[model samples]
Target: MQSRTGARWEEFLGRLDRRLVSLGLVLFTLPPLVGKWVLPLTASSPSRALQAAVEAIPPEKLVFISSDWDAGTQAESRPQLTAIVRHLLKQKRKFVLFSVNSPTGPQIAQTTVEKAIKEEDLTEEQWKYGRDWANLGYKVANTPWIRTLSRSIQEAMKEDWQNTPISELEILKGVDRWGPDGQVAMLIDVTGSATIEYWYAYLTPTKVKLGLACTGVMAPEQYPYLDSGQLSGMLTGMKGAAEYFELIGAPSPELRVTMAGQSFAHLYIVLLILLGNVPIFLGWWQRRQR
Candidate 1:
């Protein structure tokens, strides 16, 4: 009778374990993808700094953007790029975007721009390309390419990606000119690599204020620069992107869903960790020795 009762209890625990694992999977998977729950969102220190940096740009000053991310980091970097770009476009600030990180960076950037514009409920007549902003396209050989930009902006970027002469583009006409009195006011690098170090090494001397938007894994490498004042501000991964969306009062459910999924996934992991140690604490196998 005693043996039968013990076997039943063991079977029950086994069933409970399987159920818990299934529940964890469901918790982790659905929240970000389809969750409609309205959870509280608090912007982090870095997220706030990024918002402040973008807002501080005077209307007449031009912004230099280095878009260096590809699809692999699209989840985090894309939303961040979108939010920041929307803010810039809404503020009527002209910006020049280029990339040195990946060959496909330009195309990715173009798609993000379209998404941001679509969200604003504006028509092309209101925000035409090469008028409000321009894409310089991707350049090769990171270090030397960045150096070329700092040395002679016109020489490095003579034509927009559309092959239109940069001199003729309304947005680029007087900004980052070849001569000493250049108008490029700031640079924000949205990358998935170590390009921030290169930006600081090559572009800082030009007196262009620098900011960063990078993957969560790469963010730790940038805080030192932030501390030293080389980088004015930054945003990390999708968490950072969502924080920006919150700051700008974005109504994008897509971003909110992703953040919600991430939160639940973390909690599910913690539960798993606790469940994994249950057998050790209960001494289930240890008692078999008797």
Candidate 2:
């Protein structure tokens, strides 16, 4: 009778342990996906600053987006791009996209924009491709291309990515080489490369406001630019993506639930670790008493 009772207790505890870990992980991850409201995390300063800057822009002004990221860093870049695009479309801001790296950069940018538009339920009129935005596509090779663009956008980009004349694009009609009136409203760089440094050296000097979104590993490296005021705002990674989602008050099902689950899971793990350690400590205390 005593052995049976012990076995039952052990089985119960083992089952409970597994359930607690599973429940904790679910609780930690689920809110970011299904929750009606999430108290926004205050730790993501860069995303907050970026969203504030985007909100401050006039609805009519055109924003320039340089998406130099590809499949290699899609996990970070995709969400950042989605958040930015959603915000821009919501605010009715016009934008132009170009890439300094990989030939496939334009495709990735296009897909991201399209996905955001669909997800946000924005209309063609709200975020049209040719009129509200233009794609200069992959123009030149890396840093030199950025320098050329800084010197003369028109001369540097004689034709649109699709071989259309830049002059023919309604979005680019106001942009010129000389003054602020024709200048880009804001410049966004989403890249894994050092292309951002080139932008700071050449483009930011022109007084073009800049924002950045890079991978998780690159966040530390990007702080110098933010500190110097070269980058007006930034989004570091998926966490930054979630922060932006919070700011926009438009969390996707997956993100909200996942974040909640992650939080709960962390809590559960900490509890288990503490419980496990306490038993070991108690055992040591009892042995010492003997």
Per-model C-alpha lDDT, please? 0.79, 0.76
* Tens digit of per-residue lDDT, candidate 1, span 1-290: 23444555556666776776777688677855764765677888888887888788777788888899999888888988997888787777778788888889999999888778878887777888888888988888456766787887877888877788898888887565421246777889889887777778887887677889899989988888888878888888888888887788775677777777777877888877776555554565546755
RMSD of each: 5.3, 6.9
* TM-score of candidate 2 against the unseen true structure: 0.73
List residue ranges in candidate 1 displaced over 4 A. Answer: 1-27, 177-181, 272-290
For model 2 the local lDDT of residue 114 reads 82
TM-score for each candidate, following the candidate numbering: 0.82, 0.73
| Candidate 1 residue pairs that clash | 32-261
Model 2 CA lDDT for position 193? 74
